[model samples]
Target: MQFCDDCGSLMHADGDEMVCSSCGARVPKDRERAAQFVSTEKQTFDDVIESSEEAADEGLPSTEATCEECGHDRAWYTIKQTASADEPPTRFFKCQECGHRWRGYN
Candidate 1:
């Protein structure tokens, strides 16, 4: 990850040199420094465990919001900033009885 010395643009690796994408400037890559970035081992995510359906909803807080689909008065809720930072965050609700999901804007 090298930048152009003249125009401060991001540079990409060419055959033996780093070329600037924006300004077209080229710089010779140091062989010793470039070799340090090379990897020999293959990466794997075999140890990762996916969350179960019950475990996914365990941490959510519950509220008295009504479910439009099943008329349930209780629901599990989570707040997220779906809009811009200047606007209020949205409230997402999942019905405890029917597993129906809905969103409410603040």
Candidate 2:
């Protein structure tokens, strides 16, 4: 979780030091700080499934947009702020039948 002070890039825990991936900066890690950054937990499939469920479209609203790939007349959509704050948000559509994805700007 440490970042390079010079380049602001993520730093990897090397032997007795934190090495920046972007810049060649190195920072010495103390014994207490080094132990805090070490990870002993193992990742499981259940952890991935739980995290991916938040991005799923199961709870998203559906509309009557036509899918170009399958010609399906229904789709699930989500709106996101992709542009600057002064600009309008973007609408992303996913085809209900074929799982095709597209984006529309407002």
Candidate 3:
């Protein structure tokens, strides 16, 4: 397995190319070109640590939606990134008490 020269992360040989998931550095059949590409990546170990700290500071909140019919907690929060909204902000919710769903926008 060839490690990414950029991030030192493991690189998997994907068919005709080796790709580094952490740094997106692709190593072609030519080892020389891959070395150059890895050097181009500007990320460092310190950057990774700083990013983790920032994420920890921004706490994740639990889902508030509940099931109305079964009286169960149906709320869940997704820590996924999304594109910026072009329209007004909107929220969709389902009640745990009766499985009732509603949408609110502001």
Candidate 4:
């Protein structure tokens, strides 16, 4: 990106020129200027989003977990990392009927 010499604000890449928004000055696009502002290829990364649907997917064992809010008799549970590596993982429960979520330490 280029900056306006007059107003010191960032300039945008307009068609064939770099136009300053604050000062309305136009800098002609050149090979050296384009090379200085070339965009690098974006690095691919894995998505870090964890969803409730993905967590409650089929194959998890169902135990009789009572919902504290709605009194539902069923829920899906999974162990999640909540502490340091030396400690035991915590159990998370989601109610089947009312979708109430709770956690148990043991």
lDDT of 2: 0.84
lDDT of 2 by residue, 1-106 (tens): 8889999999887777889999979989868777677544444466454346435776789999999999999989999999899999999999988889999887
| Residue-by-residue lDDT tens digits, candidate 1, 1-106 | 6779999998878788889999899999978878766432456767755567666775779999889999999999999998889999999999988899999997
Query: Which pairs clash (backbone N, Cα, C closer than 3 Å) in model 2?
Result: none
State residue 72's C-alpha deviation in candidate 2, in Å. Answer: 4.9
For every candidate, C-alpha RMSD to the true structure in Å: 5.7, 5.1, 11.3, 8.5
Per-residue lDDT of 24-58 in model 3, one digit per residue for the tens?
Answer: 89977566655565443556576454365434422
- TM-score order, best first, reads 1, 2, 4, 3
Top-scoring candidate (TM-score): 1
lDDT: the better of candidates 1 and 4: 1
Question: Residue by residue across 1-106, what tens digits does model 4's lDDT show?
Answer: 7788889898877779888999899988777769777643454445634455755444576789899999989888999889998999999888888778889997
Task: Report how far residue 29 has shifted in candidate 1, in Å.
Answer: 30
Cα TM-score of candidate 3 = 0.27
Model 3 C-alpha lDDT versus the unseen true structure:
0.58
Off by over 4 Å in 2: 38-45, 50-59, 63-73, 80-92, 99-106
Candidate 1, number of clashes: 0
